[model samples]
Target: MSQNGPKMNEFEASTATEIRMDASRSTSVFLTIYSDFASAEKVWRRFEEYADCYAFQSFDFLDVWYRNIGHRSGVEMQLVVAWGAAAKPLMILPLGIETSKLGRKLVWLGNEVNDYNAPILAPNFGDCVAEGDFSRLWSDILDTLPAHDYVELMRQPKMVGHQINPFTELGLKLNASGTHMTQMSEDFDTYYDEKRTSKAKRQFRSRRKQLNEIGETKYVHPNKVEDIHASIDNLVALKSEALKAIGAPDFLAQPGYLDFYKELSAQSLNEGIGHVSHLEVGGEYAAGNWGLVFKGRFYYLLASYNGPKFGRYAPGLQALVELMRWASEKKATLFDFTIGDEGYKAEWCEIHEDLYDHIQARSLRGVVAQSLTNGFLLAKRTIKQNPKLWALFTKLRAKLANHRDFG
Candidate 1:
């Protein structure tokens, strides 16, 4: 722990709530909160194995994200570990503190970019956390941290594998949008036929024909280091341009964001967590898609295609189709489009899983913050759900972008 950071002594002094499971059960549950990331890293892997952990929660991914983005943004780490009397880890809640417009808030690590968030649970321990246990846990968590406005946990899945998510029992609000995913079939043809209507399939075939006429198109996943770097660079450039064209804030404009993805791509290639796929037209890059493969699931993360030159051929859609086919060929059980409500995603997805957000106030100031934040989120959701309002918002955003660019 850093010299200025909270110490174990401080944590013990602040909150030391003993959790009892049941009268018949002899073991007692205890909580340990750490303000430093290194302490949490020591037990992270072992605890991760106790439950069904997502790739986003892996130490590698979160550490990288924090080092690159979170730390720079002045977010403080708060890792909560629960253990039984036998010294066995039960659950790991990777959380952090940051001062937002609402006030000082405690949130899950990777809350900004992660699609799914939940407390890492021990195997078969999901249903074990009852409301009483959670209430105690929540209180203990608040006690460990400095007085804050709200505890906001967002983008949590309702289930982890076969077990129910214990957090859902705590009564978090349903997120405005849910994640979209498709169950992959045994073969590409079967998956494609199942996802697309006859008309859509015909249109896809026509698009392919047009693309072929332009040049020999090939789908490739770069394996060589140089090739991967080049592909990632191309993706960054394309994505930056696309964001600029639409008048939206360019997330990739920051050097740290670019470096994060580049490092992620390299590390993912090394660890076999994911890969970057590209579509080449006449041996020249036309489109790129980066996705992760974990536990027989393909997670679509980032994708972009060539500009107006290749727009007519629908290179983006073509690349997505090729990616789906690749996932099917690999026998992936699911193709998760992550979080979005785009029309194209709905066309392919059969499963729409609700993500959730939890907001709780600890103090009077927190209640005010919670109310303001809730109202803001509700208004934002209302606008997003209304097509006309969303369209107008986008046009206004684009005009603002243009003014900013030309000013």
Candidate 2:
């Protein structure tokens, strides 16, 4: 169990039967399962005011996702809400049920796009869980969930909003990779200098200069409805083409993926839940991007460029620089590159956060599914951690793509 998890004394997995503690103890907790977010939206939002959760867990973000993606894809919401004594809200488990190859699987809402998945916890959740047997609560919650072969809760961090994430204990498998981020100072230049060497800074400036030479370089943040939609559509197209060129399955091709982003960006970007921006060279689109800014952190999300032709001057990186500056101007304290081990992110991240995945079996098929899934994850872990293996894999993938007439 993670050190931050509820106390383990008298804890036996799936043993506790009590769903509600004696109210006199003031640690009583109850769980409710909802098939739709609307049934649980009020408490979910109420907890967000005092809960510790990433921006992705915000009610608005999830609501937008549900309306656009979940409902469209037939992803059923298994939204779990917990209440403490006097029925005070304490936690929200944003879960969903989807049919996977193995069987029906229970997972986090927006798991398809979210870099991290975790339950939003109120400030006093730890105390309540410690006072009550969390094992029993968790067991009851799982028992109440819809039928599923197994559960996969991955990419969960130990800390969220600087508070212990209760899910850390569940996602026992330590991910080989993690999220990348750079903490910002009040001054953008000071922060940039610390992350980049003098030569590297000069190189970046030169790249920007060259791009400028080609045309009047501009970083465009489109707030107008038409511009945002156009920019997002362009970015999606660019990303789709890039994936095709590399022979990778384009997620944009998936049902509701484009709608999820475009609608969210249009409705929530101005509200600070989403952001859409791009870089233009000589009055033409070079790079288009979408990100999230919430609670003083900027989460870098979908980003795409025209191609290596426009990539010559690194317009994507330039846009990031501008984003960093923009974030600093807004007094944002962190610029999160999110979850990727890409070389470009390494150039800017000040910290790397370890991620974890928890897979559990509840049935015979679930057991077999768990074993197969673990094997795949172990292989992925091995490849991700070994530089040579990753290089060889990439080369082999390229060759395979070429053989398949994709290159």
Candidate 3:
């Protein structure tokens, strides 16, 4: 039984039961599931009080994200909270239930959108776990894993925390590796000077020259509400056109997704937590980008523009450069080009944090399924690591799996 009164079904994990609580520790009882958004909010709000470094798990952030994406994603969430004196929240695991190929499973509380994933813990709580007392608390928490076939933690940023390591240590099969984008410093002049070689710098300057010589134009990041709306429309049109040309779907073009973003922008701006930037030439919206400004960090989330007209000058690149400069001027601590390992990120990235997809299985069938999945992942990794072998193996595999159903 949990030290806390009773387990909340919404946050219960299916794979594990009977958690062991630590009697020696000062931390109080644990709540298996948060009763409502308000409950989760209370815990998250305290997470900031415990640790400044873990500020991403704040109540305001959770509320905004849940408001925008929760309804459509089909993920049900719960908050795990541990309290101390006067119910000081010490640790939290944001969890959600999702239906995967294996069956119902526990997932990272945040979905694909949030860039970072880890348990929100108190400041200097690192030593608490290290002392081995919190291990019991952790085990108690794990015991609360509802009777699910698997647990999947998708897209973790960095491995410095106990969230990934603890699961693996507890006999769960761990698979840690994913793509990462750059977290460049906030000083634009210094960043560009340090990252751009003489040749690359010269290329950018030359492109600017070509753009100026070709047309009489100007670029601006609009602050007016009306101008921002117009810019968003232009960006969406360009993005839709590009996606259609490539035979892929545009995320912004999804019926409700665009409106969701617009709503998020309005809410974030109202709360002083979002920003939008645009590039205008000849008083027309050429390109636009928008993202969140949370806890002194800037996340570069989305961008779009009319294509090829400024190809020689790379207007998208130009927009990013100017926007980043603007961010630096605003004194943001970090600029996160999140969730991809594109070449552009390499140019200016000083920090490349690896993300991972973690999975834990229950039941005999789930075990076999996990084994097969890991085997396939290992093979994929092998091919990725060796290009020559990858070419040969991929061709054979593609030939074998070539069928209408593969798509």
Candidate 4:
């Protein structure tokens, strides 16, 4: 192992403990662990082409992540590209490595912005590859890891190929991550016709009519600079209102974070992966979501609102419906509602992906550290899950966060 590079752990192919027995025998694998995105261009682009098929997996997002977070955080990125003899890439996992108590640990990159993390594989691989491809891939990863004592897989959404069941079956402790999802059909009419109850359809129609009566309600899906900036403003405003409604600190209230989002918007737009969808009533913007559109899919990244004026019409829902319809028309395969399984998302989406917050601790010190971390998370989840305890827990967290000056 080079001084700056990760240590290598040699293991035999058949006897490797990490090798998943479920994958097919014919699948050949190639692995490249990167210290940074700039150095991992060849691998990043290879898998990203497959990732771009999903709207949430835009190139600009990966770029923003490289610029704002990873490089500054001293985090090492790992690029694993599993391919066949033809050298065509099959699965790509863009992972970040962090030093823990035991040794170095691996996780998905950009956890701060991206709601979900999963391997990027060509759909065609799904057909030709054997059943145990995932097992073989992990076996290779485990064998290659030298200095790492733990592998932490974070926020892998459900329904994606990397199912948690198999990992757990493989003896890795699994944590079920919290997230939300929404599904969109070919068009609004078709969606209503096939999925919605008559009452729900009528209610939405009534709301639309009411919104129209209030003033000219226009749906804006902006992909340019001027419109994107406007959408950012709305997103900030809505985020503030939403946070206040729940008596929580506004995330975008922090100048640094807001600036980061602004920079991301500019970069995403310039890179042709930016998306800003809004519902403007009369001359005022009611609500909007600023995310990214990769390939044809739409990622509902962020949003804001004009509380009192557009609250009745559910401007947020309107924007989502409009954007989803547009994406469908554009031949998008999915509309990601993004992280957190909120009530609204349950009503809108049919798909539910499971993501795990994983931590691996091999050494004694690592075990102690893992216990502390996992204990805190477990306590937090307990409080958050109970409605009666949530308010008190929130206040406590807020007070601690304020004292810590979390940014």
Pairs in steric clash, model 2: none
* Global lDDT of each candidate: 0.77, 0.79, 0.61, 0.62
TM for every model, in the order presented, reads 0.89, 0.91, 0.78, 0.75
What is the number of backbone collisions in each predicted candidate, taken in the order shown? 1, 0, 11, 20
Worst lDDT 10-window in candidate 3? 11-20
Q: In model 1, which runs have C-alpha deviations exceeding 4 angstroms?
A: 1-17
Which portions of model 3 miss their true places by more than 4 Å?
Answer: 1-29, 49-58, 131-139, 159-187, 213-219, 224-226, 240-255, 372-407
RMSD of each: 4.2, 5.8, 5.4, 6.3
Among all windows of 10 consecutive residues in model 1, the one with the lowest summed lDDT is 1-10
Model with the higher TM-score, candidate 1 or 3: 1
Per-residue lDDT tens digits for candidate 3, residues 1-407, read 53444334333322322233444663345444663476455446646654543324556555656666664677777666654444444567777777767677776654655666667666555444555455566556655655666666655554423333333344333233344334546567887788689998788788767766756556665556676666666776787776555444456665455655555555544665556677766565667887777666678877877677765567788788888887777777677787655567777776766655566666676676667767876776566556587568656655554442255
Tens digit of per-residue lDDT, candidate 2, span 1-407: 11122232322122212255445674456566667666566767777878888888888888888887777767778877776666566778888888877877778898878998888888888877863355566767888777788888888987877667766545389886889998899999888888888898898899989988899999998888888888989899999887766667788988878777887788754574888889999999999778888878889988889776687777878888887898899878988999979888888886998989989898999999899999999999999889999888877876777778743
Judged by whole-model lDDT over C-alpha atoms, candidate 3 comes out at: 0.61
Give the 10-residue window scoring lowest on summed lDDT in candidate 2: 8-17
Task: Kindly give the stretch of ten consecutive residues in candidate 4 with the minimal lDDT sum.
Answer: 10-19
Clashing pairs in 1: 50-123
| Residue 279, candidate 2: alpha-carbon lDDT | 91
For model 1, residues 301-369, the per-residue Cα lDDT tens digits are 899999777888788989999988888788788999998788888888889998888888877878998
Candidate 2 local accuracy as lDDT?
A: 0.79
**TM match of model 1 to true structure:** 0.89
- Choose 1 or 2, whichever is better by lDDT: 2
- Give the best candidate by TM-score: 2
